[model samples]
Target: MKRHDALIRVAEYDRFRRPTSIRIDVTAGCPIPVVRTIFGAPDKPTETVVNVSLVTESHPTLDPTRKYKDRCRLARRIADRLGIDEGCHVRVDAGPYATYYRVYEIREHDAPLVVHEEHLDRLGIDGEQTVRLSTTIPQETPEQVRERGGLAETLVDDQTCEGVLVTAPHGGAVERGTDAIASRTYDRLDDGGVRASLWLLQGYNPPEGSAVTAHRRWHVGGFDRAVDGYPGLATLTGRAFDLVVGVHRSGYEWIEVGGRIDASVRERVADELRTRAGREVRTDLDRLHLPGTNPRISTNFLSKGGDRGLHVECTPGTCDRHVEEAAAALAETIRRVLA
Candidate 1:
């Protein structure tokens, strides 16, 4: 099937449903731990508020506009339901078709800028302070990592990849295939700290003879080598780009950028070819050959035995507009070769 047709099918399958909410029962006094367990940790330490509550929204089908509103309403309802004498802590996260809510309480002493001379004197600290650290890892597949313990904050980029921020209780660790990819630690004086860790997987290569792989090859280059060797690019591809695009498009939610090819670029190339051919063009990048690193466009129009199939491949990160230009260039190359 063509890439456009495949995308349309994915959209159809994601049809939205009516909104619904779920209120989880949480312990009152242990708000920090409970909140962390449910929604990871707060962006800041003093930000931890105890009177928090959590709610989830669901629907029968897609309702893009009302989804965020529904999530807000559910959060307010959870706050009202808690009905604590003190102010309630609330945070809401809503997506194209899903939403999550969290509420908690705040302790006065936890607030910063408040003088705690006695506490500081005992700890031998000079003044108010905070600590922050970040790190990431590599994985074979995103499914290899487990997400049961904490909520994940996802960052979406132009490509389909996502960067996820996960927080858990201090001293706890995130499990990734029997290995601890990240661990949360805290000191006696510290409120709590998040052990920032990341898991990256190499760019995806479709299994041989698989329909999905075949489809991807037709639209984009078959192998994604941009992220294969480099650690930074691999992390971005797996943790961010792969998650956003692959999850929504493939019906699988995980972060993995299998190759260096930019998806948007491939789509644009396919679109241009379809337009120029004045009919649907079948792309077959799988058989095309190029150097491991920098590749120059080349072609073989006639085989020793018979006419060889026309092939087109692209550089990593090529956008759709560029892909279109490249495809046109390839067509010209073919014309010259045949002549």
Candidate 2:
């Protein structure tokens, strides 16, 4: 499916993970094709056709109060629209069961931002599902973004393609201490004589107390590498690697590790996290929410054919206070697995 990037937001959820917000933005002008049939005979199904013209709005141009030029401009604006089919609906791939709904309307403000209703009947969302969907990233990076808030940087070894890549897709104030953990992990791995590559994306200037709530704005999922036009992530994703490890912060208290890495490697990492980091470690797949097992996730996509990708979710306290210990746990895992 074609993905278009739009600003997506979700309000706080209740104990059952049901969204309580009034508005949620899904996409910008992404067309969803719905097919239907027109029956000419009462008892017979006649012809089927896709109505593409319904994607945009239209009205009579014969308004007496408006000038010809103004009317023409308005007509053109209405003619150019990203459309969704009338009967075809959109599915939110944010949770276990895909929720199909058609209660969305696109508002043509500065950019097309779609607003949709909350409460997907019965689907239980695991939070990450909201941000895990893919979207297109514009090829151009804006000037103000480059100068201040959003940043993407990379340090790669050009000599070989056998190195492992470590990335923190949501870094800086977006997730607080993730940048430090990712940076330190890369450094420790390099120090331990393991060839490694690093890509860090950081966000700054979140609303005074809304740092966690604003993460969706800065988080360009690992699946979408158009991250602020840095090109580093896209380039790294294209290369063959010995392993790919993604470090992230999670709400869980225990350090959670997931992905397609071997059983033995996972056990070693869990043991290290428990011994060196002195934290509870959880590697059981059945209990992980952000397991990074999806094939499109950065760790899975960048790992050498799904054999060596590790997704490690550190608690907020660990990221803030024990970043070094967590990084050591991962660095040791990488050294033993790839070195």
lDDT of 1 by residue, 1-339 (tens): 211111100001011111111112234442222111111222222211223222222332212243122111222322233222122212221111111111123233233112223222211234434311001112122232122111221111122223222111111111111111111111100122211222222222222112122112111111122222212232233332111111001122211112123334334434554454333332334422321112210011111111121222222222212333433533332233323
Q: Clash number for model 2?
A: 1
Candidate 2 lDDT, tens digit per residue, 7-96? 232234333222222122436464422212111221222111111211112334322232111111111222132123222222223222
TM-score, one value per model: 0.18, 0.57
In candidate 2 the C-alpha lDDT for residue 118 amounts to 23
lDDT score, candidate 1, position 282 = 28
TM-score of 1: 0.18
Each candidate: RMSD: 24.1, 18.0
Candidate 1 vs. truth: CA RMSD? 24.1
Candidate 2 Cα outliers beyond 4 Å, as residue runs: 1-148, 206-212, 222-230
Candidate 1 global lDDT: 0.22
